[model samples]
Target: MAVSHGHKGINFAQTTSICLNFIQEALLKHQWQRASEFLQHYFQALEDFNSQKRQVALQNIWKLGSAILYHHPKSNVETFNAFADRMKNIGVQNYLKISLQHALYLLHKGMVEEAYRNLNQAESWRYGEMSASQEKIIKLIQAYRGLLDYYTWSKKRTELSKFDMDGFATSAATQDMHSYFRQASVNLHEIIKIPGVWDPFVKSYVEMLEFYGDQDGARQVLTDYAYDNNFPSNPNAHIYLYKFLKKEKAPEDKLISVLKILHQIVPSHKIMLEFHMLLRKSKKEEHQKLGLEVLFAVLDFSGCTENITAWKYLAKYLKQIMMEKHLNWVQEGWSSRKDWWPTFHFSYYLAKKNWKENKILALEKAFTSGILLGKGCKYFMYVSKQGHKVQKKSIKTMKKFVMKHNILDSEEL
Candidate 1:
């Protein structure tokens, strides 16, 4: 009873300071659970402070708490509950921070419905408090747009479609919708027109172009972006550019350069396999030879045991090339494997082309293997059906031969 001050004597400032120190200690020790607990008590103490100055104290607490929560990697129910409770205690005067933190927390927790609700509320409630910094407002807008972009890229189309962009524009802090659009357009224009801006800027620029239905402009931008940037150093970028050029029917030389860069990057089995497929599609004999050499080199390094898909492609390519060149050794090598039933079918195709001159008997060996009975039966029927009417006798022989090796019953076939 000497001064009769009691707990109130400590003052809100002292309580806040002590709480901050405890929070710092918990963070340093990586005790997020304990840190959230401390923040709950700290916010409660602030709520109990003098009513006249409570608004200022609440605003200060929210700012500091948000900074902490935003950077922490691991957040949980307790962390969000603490933030929500502080917002409720602070009243509507601190609504923007309250709603923003709630939205962010819900987003982190994968509760998108609740996050969208809170974001809408935050946008609606935001007042002149944000008038101090246009840059901060721009950052906030970007954050919202970034979340939209995430949903778009990740194929969450239904969720992205639910968002009301018009509503967002109406409630946004900027002067008008054109300001946002202008800023975005300018950024993307720079991305396409300037060098060294490709990495950080292409994704956004492409997205914006897509949104506006500017397909031709988007293609042009991609062309310029690829031209200004070095594609050879990055195989993935090179492939993406190559695919784009292929779709546009760009010069054969441009596509060949892509293949050359890929070959230079690594002699990996997959890359060699892709090169062979591309060369065959382009119908370039010299490139096909080079691709074949690379494929053989890869086989030497890793052997034919690995890369089953590559083996399938290589076998098909070899069958086609050997047929065109009339190489008997290639056909002999192809028949040596139990798994080359498909190659036998390819050989059947070539033999059918010159059936009278070739005297092909490989189909007899293939039918005996029973490997071509299931899926191969349908292909055999298709080829037999395509025979000339004058070769109707051969067709009949083929049909009877296929029926003998058919995997399914007569009705099923």
Candidate 2:
């Protein structure tokens, strides 16, 4: 059903409050499907309200837009445009942030000139001395301008532009890629010196250094970026250093050191899979255990939830670890977990060791009804041609896969 602003008693703020309350309630219960329905209803009401009226508190408007960006998976360019336009129409304070974000969206879409124009608009708002945050924004604007100039030069590499030649050296009369890179370097240099996550600026500076055959400089810059105490704890900084070292063919021990530190920081980093695979082949037992943890993580990923291969590996590994006790473990999901791990291989073993057609049908019927997982759902309809009430015990493996400290090698306590 659609809500109408024409309703005499209904208010936008009240509607927003009610809609968000229900949506959040659903989300708290891990009911994403229900939350999605509530979200759609809220947006539908918003659109209806927009047709009749556009006046609202800026905070309310911000909240409305933020719901999509933070909660919805389908947020995109058009959504951002709508959000920025809403903010701009009300002459929102800190307006440069709106332009800056819009500029980033344009850059993402490859609208380089348009993005530069947005940065220019943002920069124009500055007057007199700026605050620390404003200063950061200004530097970002200049950094983006450097990127724009570099992009322009790239398109015109062989563009017959005049050059200023010096003994065995020459510089373009107008800004070229090299000169633009230098400009980017200078703009980025000071910004990176202060400890902070300067992803874009640091990347630009490092790339410039590498292009100018300053490998040593690039290495040191990445080293400082990763290890500097002034910077917040960040895994990507270390990952950047690790990649740089790998590309430079740094020693094995050095590569391992960075990887170890990164793993200690973010154990479930996707890149750790390759390292774990090699660890699996190592002669050490501890390394082998760590290797299998990656498979567990792979299975935990949304798309890989149904991955049978990973399930099989973990089951076999579990059996190996348990030895004689493997068979003693019930084939049914009577036990909460397949050991105390983050994922279980219940499906593989359940199907293999005990697959009576009737038992499968019963399980399906249980899922489709309020008997096992609660509330009947049509999504599980295909699992059984006919569903009837079944005992909750028939269902197996609601393994609490909460990964509190999944990393095996604990930091020294």
Candidate 3:
């Protein structure tokens, strides 16, 4: 199953497999640069191959494309599309996936008509397929179609509100409204019946319910589908539930109860952060203490996004709490991770407060982690000046590292 490239019998399939293996290994190790390099090699190796080999290459290309989408949402669109066009040229007929992506991209850019047309094309492609995979794709297409229709109706409704509608035009609008809702209901029902875990379709349905001013309906749907099961990984569903309860102004006790349930179910950094946010809304020391606990939980859950704001706020809380307790947070060595951006700031604050050698050691740990200086280098140095003088060797090393990496200076305090 090897595709021979040149007279020397270069095996493209073996090389491609090796590249994929290396990519996976790099990703597993969180070596993103290495993973990206391997992906580029895979793409290069697949170019200009025969049709038989092209299909397999396209499959791997899509795999890499999806991984890129997940890891780096703001990646180059032209490059992605170039790969996609190459895939299409190789006789891969799964245009629905491509069209849906394009539709969403267009919609995000506010090209409503183009987005609508792309969605319609995706819907048309759904008619002739009945495979298990196709069924999932069809459900997704239905969700997007319903979303597009909702957006269109909303825009038209806004425009119609400015005019004195004649009877004929009013009737036409009424008919359109009826047709839209009827189709929406059908899509919602089908999505609900699809047997599996919750997905983007479920999120879309919940959004549609919310858009139609059915807050209760949206809450019920999320509760039944998203929360009724084990810990769901969908952040949108969690946010939707929190927003609904917040809008209702649920009691503190009730909110705490729900937070406890969500925390126990997921135990991730987001839920912990949300719990802290909720506690911050309260005007009491005990609630703030609870918020501090939530911060600790955030550090405990390593799956959190690299949220600098949360870490900075957490440092402030730690300082405040330590002052009240008449203790040194620096001595406590309160750091979640040594190699994260937040750790640098946290260590800086600890060093400034204590002015101890141990604190300097902690700061050195954060500096060497290589994750600290992205946008906080100047501020880090500012805080360092407030504390004990950093070692000359350490300063020189940091200077070299910054120069090599070209981290932009941020005038943040």
Top-lDDT candidate index: 3
Each candidate structure's TM-score, on Cα atoms with residue i matched to residue i, is: 0.38, 0.52, 0.52
Clashes of each: 0, 0, 0
Model 3 misplaced regions, further than 4 Å: 1-6, 9-54, 58-115, 118-129, 161-171, 192-204, 207-213, 261-292, 298-413
Query: Where in model 2 is the C-alpha error above 4 Å?
Result: 1-93, 153-175, 277-338, 341-343, 346-413
Residue 413, model 2: Cα distance from true site in angstroms: 26
What shift in Å separates residue 333 of candidate 3 from its native position after superposition? Answer: 13
Q: Which clashing pairs does model 1 show?
A: none
- Backbone clashes in candidate 2 total 0
Q: Report the candidate with higher TM-score, 1 versus 3.
A: 3
User: lDDT per residue, candidate 3, 1-413, as tens digits?
Assistant: 22223436546666677777877887788666667766767775556457757666666766666566446635555655565555545543556666677667666667778777767766766344467776677687777777666666556666767888789988888678657666766676576665455555566566667767887887787666646555445545555566567777967766665676666556664657768777767777667666766665565554542344456556555445544652323223323342454543444454444334344444443342222343244444543344334455654554455444322232220
lDDT of 3 at 393: 61
Q: lDDT rank, highest first?
A: 3, 2, 1
Off by over 4 Å in 1: 1-74, 77-184, 188-204, 207-216, 229-232, 249-253, 266-274, 293-306, 318-413
lDDT of 2 by residue, 242-357 (tens): 88998998865577668777777776566666565555556666555655555555544556534444444554444343343322222222123335322232333333332244
Query: Model 3: C-alpha RMSD to truth?
Result: 13.1
Q: Between 1 and 2, whose lDDT is larger?
A: 2
